[model samples]
Target: MMTRAFRTAAVVGAGTIGLSWTALFAAHGLTVRVSDPRPDLDEAVTEALTRYAPHLAARGLDVTGLADRVRIAADVTEAVRDADVVQENGPERAEFKRELFATLTREAPAHALLLSSSSAIPSTAFTAQLPDEAAARVLIGHPFNPPHLLPLVEVVPGARTGEDAVRAAVDFYTSLDRTPVVERVEIPGFVGNRLQNALSREAVSLVQQGVVTPEDLDRIVTDSLGLRWATVGPFLGAHLGGGPGGYRHLVEHIGASMQSLTDGPAPDADAQERLIGAVEKAYGSAPYAELSETRDRRQLAVLDALSETTGTTTPKEEN
Candidate 1:
């Protein structure tokens, strides 16, 4: 067996997020067992890994024989039996997660780290049914979109999650070269998604109000805030924006302007349909494959450029 901090992983779910986790795990030399009830499990994983191979290579990861290290388990129990880490990407509903996690904690090894890729819905909500010992190992390890590419994994512990689990979660994600930020309070949507949702609401409002087309709105953000945030993040960027004064100075000077900006209107069903239509009209013409490929290519370029500036690169594992 391969020796590492966390040698074997069980990825529970085979959707986009689950498959991405599988690719990253196998790329890092962990033996992976993936489970999903979907009939096309084998085909889906094969296609996703094949598509992700080049991007993983560009990120300086050795993906040779990657698929050979991953296996499709017979069931959820089988998937997690001896797992050192269990990453659950199951449905986001609280009820579904409650039942799923109960099974996971019962089956997975006692010392395994149980993580969820849930966008929201705190671990406490679902883990209420679990015993203290089982609940201690489970927490939200939410990743930003496309877990294979993005560098962040928000580590939000449940109310009952032990300190040991919290520290272990951080260490495990760090080993994979992921930036794991722990949220002291487990708020809805956690930090990244809350900020992203706030921005998304305004972006939708802008397109719906005809302030800009969907395509132009994307360009505007990618050229400005998106690029800026990628570099310094929001608060740091604002600190720099303050000239020599820092965030406090910037806020004092532009506080009025910032406060004057009205909150975006909450869209009704009709408005949502229109927003979707507008977005589809703008970029839906392109095939999903083309769009995804273009996105990965550009994102890889940005990551490479950042690596050059920082004099560091992503850690590559021997497979």
Candidate 2:
């Protein structure tokens, strides 16, 4: 693996994801240059960092000099100048990303890893327009929402991407204390989002069928599947659920039942309406800011508990 240590990083985009990344980089003592077109970019980023600073501290990351290390760049080219890695969080349009990656390939340093935070689009979609040499350095380093707190970062490489570039990208994120999973294949949605959406589809179907209220459905997950998955992922959970016989026992006993559920009809238009109405009734009255704060606090508490049980510090402790 590449042992290159990055000192300065560039953030392309000052939106939510970009701002979160900027905060994390600065908190970890990397000089962060952020580029965005927003008129209130500086003010917005400062406010975001201020809000996240305490959370970072709670997770064992020092906030000292964090604000001093972050600067707003005048443009993309300027943002990436003298940087070791470029984390692009620009608009998620195919054409826009294609043009942006091409510009990044031309402007950024040849050795710097060109990483995109694109969720759906693969690296090939943007790197297709670049020459082989430049495209070899471009790939997707897609992070979960609220990346500063979440540990998962999917490192996916395009067909033309070099192994060294992929290794550098993975090492870069691993340095940031992220769980970097190198995807062997470049598929849409990677892995986490696909699993989340699959569960969501079934959850919506259950609610639409009036099998459970929206609140109850959420409660069921939190009390059972969610809690279980937090400790052991689905596959392992199934292996344990099968007792001493393991996964083979699970398949032999419930394979048909699982297959039947998988083959069930997907949610239709009426189901979508019902799901929407149920969700609206449950949370539509609350302000989004309040809900998000609640979510972050709960997530932090869970991480703390997990850390205590696992005898390992949270990712932020690496700082």
Candidate 1 — which residues are off by over 4 angstroms?
1-4, 263-319
C-alpha RMSD for every candidate: 12.6, 12.0
Tens-place lDDT per residue, model 1, 28-134, is 99999999999999999999999999989999999999999999999999999999999999998999999999899888889899999999889999999899999
Candidates' C-alpha lDDT = 0.85, 0.84
Q: Candidate 2, residue 247: CA error in Å?
A: 0.8
Relative to the unseen true structure, what is the C-alpha lDDT of residue 151 in candidate 1, on a scale of 0 to 100?
A: 85
Per-residue CA lDDT of candidate 2, range 242-306, in tens? Answer: 55555556666886677676667655767645654554465556555555455445555677786
- Candidate 1 clashes between residue pairs 3 or more apart in a chain or in different chains: none
Worst 10 residues of 1 by lDDT: 287-296
Best by TM-score: 2
Q: List TM-scores for all candidates, in order.
A: 0.81, 0.82
